[model samples]
Target: MSPYNALIGGVTATLLLGFAAQAQSDTLADIRERDVLSVGIKNDYPPYGYLDENNEIVGFEIELVRYIANELLGSPDKVELIPVVASNRIELLNSGRIDLIMATLGVTEERAQVIDFTEHYVSAAGASVLARQEARFDQWEQLEGQNVCGIQGAYYNRTLTDHYGIRLVNFTALPEAYRALQDNRCVAMVFDDMTLRQKLGEPGWEGYKIAVEPYEYLPMAGGVRKGDEAFLDAVNAAIVKAEGEDRLIDWEGEYDMPPSDHIAARAEAARAVAE
Candidate 1:
């Protein structure tokens, strides 16, 4: 073979080998061998996954992932929680930065095309505005012309802006917007109901409240990289087993969320799928 042709062939073979190595990555076996269950979780969205007063990540999703770790590795202490946010969670998963994404990832057809999701675990949640009662927000119609804080990459920003003509002050992190809310930078923070509700219940947020209830609902699920059926199936089984054991109900209680009929029904269905 010509020298130029041989060099090209060698480069192509090396590139092919790299892709093959990534494609054949056995995440479950790696975790087992490393004795670490690395999971991506939200560190700002409270009651799902957030930092406590001690700066430790703690919440219902944290507990759920810990349960899965305990089941898989025979010890919850082996779990390593990697903090993630909305815009980059899927990218982090697909890029192999994290083994699984247990963040409060909403399910949608667009997102499913990019990454695989386990069976829906949490019931569908809706969007709402966390505003100070002084802002006097009573309905969605009242939001017109108001400046609302929102997280970057959230679907709600376009809806609030285009649909309602509201001005959006976008932030990369929820905590930044939360600070903006505290400082009166924005009239309200538009986000998922669960995170806002959790913040509202905390003692320091005395004057803030959800101005209006959620207008729409979306399912939430655990996310994993694509083309790994064995790992996906194992994670799904862990969730299903937990549902069958009523851990979802316990999680609701532990997280201080009001009893949810939708969550109960969803848990029942997940358990049925397990059977």
Candidate 2:
């Protein structure tokens, strides 16, 4: 055989071996071996996943996942919470650092290609406007040539700037964006309804309010690795059970406002299917 042919054969064999090893390294096997499900969450987003005055991680999603872990593993204590950021959530799941993600993950087709999503637990709609309650921006189109503040890697930036013809000013955190709105650095800050409500309700948030209305509703769901069918199925079953028992909505109500009509409708739908 030629020298080049031998080299090609060796490379092919190495690649095949790597693929075989990876195929056997399934998330189900890891979870069963450890007897603990690790969940990824955001430690900063208020009313969803954030540290409280006690310096403990506590929020709606955190509480809901505890109930899910209980139903799945027969004990709520058999889970670990790994705090994650928006940009790294998918990578953390793909790398097996966490078995599930319950952060405020927006479900999109692009994301679904790489991870499996449980039934959507929360829904959101995007809107943009300044903090001034008396501002008259009635639609997203009205923001042309106006600067809007958003998180550094927010999912809505492209749509707000490219599609909606608004100038975007990116911030590293939610608080920064809120501060920018308060300081009048930008004419508006685009964010989802749930988060906006929480921020606006914070003390000294009298200037900011939802504007331009909600253009679209985004379904938010938990995430698992792409090929973990068993884990995905278990998580979905747990979600359905929570919906049927009203546990998910109750948890959301505890930290955030009550579940919106859309969330209730989705929960009811999940219940119907589960029944």
Candidate 3:
């Protein structure tokens, strides 16, 4: 409303942006001086980041982050893994609560504005619908007006609702959504295709199937505070190194994940560049 109020708001926004820029510009040096790399990650997402039987955090992304820590800080144990949900990972990074985000963060135009991304590492399949084996819908458009389970803050939530006309039943976490699905609270549960595929092999999921395939694939990458050039470059270099060494391929087998041509191609390319 008032002109003076608008001016004050604009000034405050500019100062906040300035502060954020200043904070990130030297993050690489800060991480080294502190002798630790603080990372926001998902401890509830399996094969990416989740707790093992020992209740210790472990996953494909967890190993990657640890590798990065070792490459940058001299030891994998020099990293701190903070569990983060999709809704809060970016906020945690921007607020300086974490130095980086190695969660299953998809690179998108909206997220790019708030945080810079490392090398696009994984060509992850986007949302797909999981339903009972007898369920027939196999296309995104076929779910019009149907209730579908989903995670809150997923990047594809708007597309599922607006473009496909699906009524999404949002949950804060995967376990709750999976629970609601088992109770038949929704027609289908929609989530990352890779993770859902892994679920189908679990003991109780044999009766279900991937009812719909992904409409698109997203490039997943690590997130750092915006304008963190040195840190971004360092992280990217480490990823490329890992690719060159075929570490990603080894991690995939260790995690019991299906092989991906996307990762294989990257590893081949990285080796070529290295030679």
Please report the candidate that would top lDDT against the real structure: 3
After superposing candidate 3, which stretches have Cα over 4 Å from the reference?
1-19, 129-191, 203-212
Candidate 1 off by > 4 Å: 1-24, 128-192, 195-213, 273-275
For candidate 1, the per-residue lDDT at 50 reads: 86
| Residue-level lDDT tens digits of model 3 in 1-275 | 11232343344334456455556567999999999999999898778899999999999999999999999998999999999876666667777889999988776665565678999787777778899999998999999999899989887889899999999999999999999999999999999888799899899999999999889877789988888888999999999999889999999999988787788999999999989
Tens-digit lDDT string for candidate 2 (27-117):
7667778888899987887778899999999888888788888877778888899998666666666666788989888776556556678
What does the lDDT read for residue 85 in candidate 2? 68
- Badly placed stretches (over 4 Å) of model 2 are 1-21, 24-33, 86-88, 130-137, 142-192, 203-208
Whichever of 1 and 2 has more lDDT, that candidate is 1
**TM-score of every model versus the real structure:** 0.66, 0.71, 0.71
Q: How much does candidate 3 score in TM-score?
A: 0.71
Using TM-score as the yardstick, the better of models 1 and 2 is: 2
Global lDDT of each model?
A: 0.77, 0.73, 0.85
